[model samples]
Target: MIDKSNQQSFQRLRLNLRQLEVFVATARGGSTRAAADRIARSQSAASTSLADLEAALGVELFDRIGRRLLLNESGRALLPKAQALIDQAADVQALFTDEYAAPLRVAASFTIGEYLLPSLVAQWTQLHPKSQIQLRIGNTSEVVAAVAGLDVDVGFIEGAQTHSDLVTRPWLADEMVIVAAPTHPLAGRLATAGQLADATWVLREHGSGTRQIADEWLLKHLGQVRVGFELGSTEAIKRVVAASDGLGCLSRHAVTQSVADGHLVELQTRLPKATRKLAIVLHREKRLGHATRDFLAHCSGVKQ
Candidate 1:
């Protein structure tokens, strides 16, 4: 006869570390084959491990979507808890085994990620050699969502977010400048609001912070602005502006090198200066890691 307490412990042990590992890998990799490659296991082993995990949990974690596996609702619900458990386990191990903790995970929008953060990250990593720094770069909205959802420790975005779940602090000011190639007809002319409206405009994709500010500014002054093309990346937008007659609005940081090299010319406009508040955002309730806090201090000018 099995002892009652022993039975409960045995049942709990079924959802063991191996199961957690497989589940996490599958969730992240989105397929058994990919998870197997990530964990250095055979595809059959990964599939068996996932089957064991689902059986132990008594819940279907993923649904097959064509050839790929996607997290089902239960898997989606379990993801954060599983991640937190793993993070906590790593933290506990660090407490006992490691001399220093792991590096901070930080996310930021593309403009800052590409131009501003590399130097800052390098400087911070140099100052603390044992500390690791990981960065995730996305559009402004994606960064905000990541921070809000606790997918990233913190994020920097070039626009204001009104979400109540996030605490946003203004870190810096950024400006969007209208630009075109030197050969474009508007290159030398001081463009009036109406003339600016008449020109073909290449714009950033919808979710970009730069696009939001540009839209608001254009709507207010030009009554309505029509976009001739929508490109997903600043680099692509710059290329389009450089090779064509279309005008583009881009962060000053993004186009600085081009402007200096004279590949792109800033279009002087009668419109008011378009400024945006770059903000550091984090969840209101999350406790930030020491490395994250240190980086935030550096960004806020509270530290060197």
Candidate 2:
């Protein structure tokens, strides 16, 4: 255990608030000019602040390779610590500012963000109205990465991940159902693994968690299907499936309305159910704030 005096000494060695702020901004924005614009500081001032921070720490934070500013080894090593310090500082500021200070920053994948999280967030806000909530929606991989990198306090993702830096807890179960338009030739037919291999498939983009699961399942059962198109959004995939002869694998939640409205028909297949474990992920070393903790508890079905 670190002694309290040693902890204080280490804190003393940390960059001051202004320098830390500038460092974090530059690291996130990928350039001094972008950081300056974000923080309302001049570009020269941002650059000077970063230089002063590196000089004080005796390490170089960024390497100027061509036009881009990339984080060096030292920068990568210090980034999480710097971010933690900033989060702690924000907590300190919040402590003195009445009851609540700012919105909780959350990142979530497309399906969860679009189909599931609205009710949960609404309930959370009703209980803690003073606590604001900001959400960033992305694909599953992006959401997982955002939480692991401390870019957001928490993330809701659609599938299991093995990232060592993150602590993942099962939050929900999502089913991936294979579906096609009612007018498609395969609409009423039961598909065998061999039959599915011959049909054209509309797939999600590369980094989407749904896409990863779909691909893995396909590889395990059908080896490789004939892909007709790759789409980025779930809605777009649904539209393409409705208009084309291609079949699609999508979250059951995503196409519930379409299925009910007779636009799409779920195909019964010989393959096993493609159920995915949706997870709530957080940085392993980060402490959760009140609002963040509250949200997690709600998702976990634990009453505060």
Candidate 3:
């Protein structure tokens, strides 16, 4: 027991989830009425909640223009903190239920998301049957952007793509292969740089991690080459290359099944081997909850 007079006084917290939730919804929806609809509250109630939050913080979180509410610098600063607190509170509530945990939000680039994560996610779900995952698939640029923006809990990306706001951990090693139809002249033969350079290629789009690496590898030896088609999907590139005389550079994992099925043949070339490191990325400021941490541990096991 300490003396009552010596005890330090602390300020009582005026912030509440209701106010934060209202504020977040309003920020996302851009209007109080829109927030009301989103959170299933009356327009007046949403407006009141937003007003209370602003008053408690003693600063206007939003800038008013006509009927719209746009986040100012202060509001932008507070948004991620508010979202984290809400997720943590939900995690606490979920502990008492039969559910495994709060939903894990993940974004992944094309190769990992399509060829890799399905089996890993299925394995994770088997161990924790009630777990929920929301996975968004895009290219590495989008994955990096998603993690940097705090739009997802974590991201998996291919190649050396990175962001200053993200911490990248090398998660797996992957190889790239050049592929073409079996009937193509380069099939089953070691080709010179001139033969490779003269070939028309079908490759991924400009923003893709695969394209970045492919360009680095190809441009270094082959110089300028003709692009027959630029596609967004790895599968689309595989199919187009298999049907036409055009060649493709893609992940070995992405083209393995097609190569096995005789739909596409791996080309032997004199160019140096292409290999890349796939990485797990997270925002520097993100606070990992238990579910996210556990999932990361599960991912680490794959390298073993």
Candidate 4:
């Protein structure tokens, strides 16, 4: 047990908020390079911060396994504490600032970010002109991590993937539709597994909620389909698929506009389950901020 009463022992500690922030980033990213990108730091600088943190605490936070950095027991235990510190710091930063002006930090997975959140946020902001919203978009894994780390007030994720630290509520239903360019061979007809296998499939990068569902559907039906390219954004994938012979699995919501604009064609393939529920995610222990709760309520089907 750490003794808070020991003034001499407390004086010897050299840890600071930056080191804690670095530790949390590394844990969330699972690698020094990814952590550096998340925190906007150089790889060497992030590594040095981690090293300093470990030395100050007299314990190794991450287990070095080949090129991957896995959080060891110590690292896992320290994560929540670090997250709490970061959240508290944000609270302190907002203390004297106008509450309405403080941005309602929202994290969302690609599908929701591209299709739904913008319009929803826009509508809400018209009602509360002073309210501000900042949307951070990432994959399911990243959004879950951000919510668990208290980096965002709320998150919306597609599919049934749930996190232990988040309270998930079924928000909306989304359909996964396979699409292609109007000029492609599979454009207006039913495509078989062999036909789809022959064409290039442009997919979202790994860890995306849409990608996770798409991978399962492809593995079961298309068996070892070739991915021509992996992209980070739903809009980017839709544009690429509209211009190339590549097939893309994306949210129906995401591709609806493109299909209507005569740029893309929806393929009729037998999918195991084309449907999944989008969930509202929030840290189990974190209280919802006023603006965030209002948006969340809107998503949950409340007329307000």
* Residue 165 lDDT, candidate 1, scale 0-100: 92
Q: Is candidate 1 or candidate 3 better by lDDT?
A: 3
Order the candidates by TM-score, highest first — what do you get? 3, 1, 2, 4
- Worst ten-residue run, lDDT, model 4? 295-304
lDDT of 1 by residue, 262-292 (tens): 9999998888898887889999999986667
Give each model a TM-score: 0.68, 0.66, 0.69, 0.65
Off by over 4 Å in 4: 1-102, 159-162, 302-304
**Candidate 3 Cα errors over 4 Å, as ranges:** 1-92, 95-99
Clashing residue pairs found in predicted model 4: none
The residue-by-residue lDDT of candidate 4 on 1-304, one tens digit each, is 7677797777886999889988999899988889899999999999999999999999999899988899999998999989999999978777537556667888989888878888888777887677778899989889899989998998888855567888888888888899999999877788888888788999999888899889888887878879999999998998999889999999998989899999899998765657888888889999877666766776665331
Q: Score each candidate by Cα lDDT.
A: 0.85, 0.86, 0.90, 0.86
Steric clash pairs (candidate 1): 103-132
Q: TM-score for candidate 1, please give it.
A: 0.68
**lDDT of prediction 2:** 0.86
Evaluated with lDDT, which candidate comes out highest?
Answer: 3
Greater TM-score among 1 and 4 belongs to 1
Q: Write candidate 2's Cα lDDT for 8-127 as tens digits.
A: 899888568789889889889999999999899999999999998999998888999876789999889988988899899888897548444467889999888887787788887777
RMSD of 4: 17.6
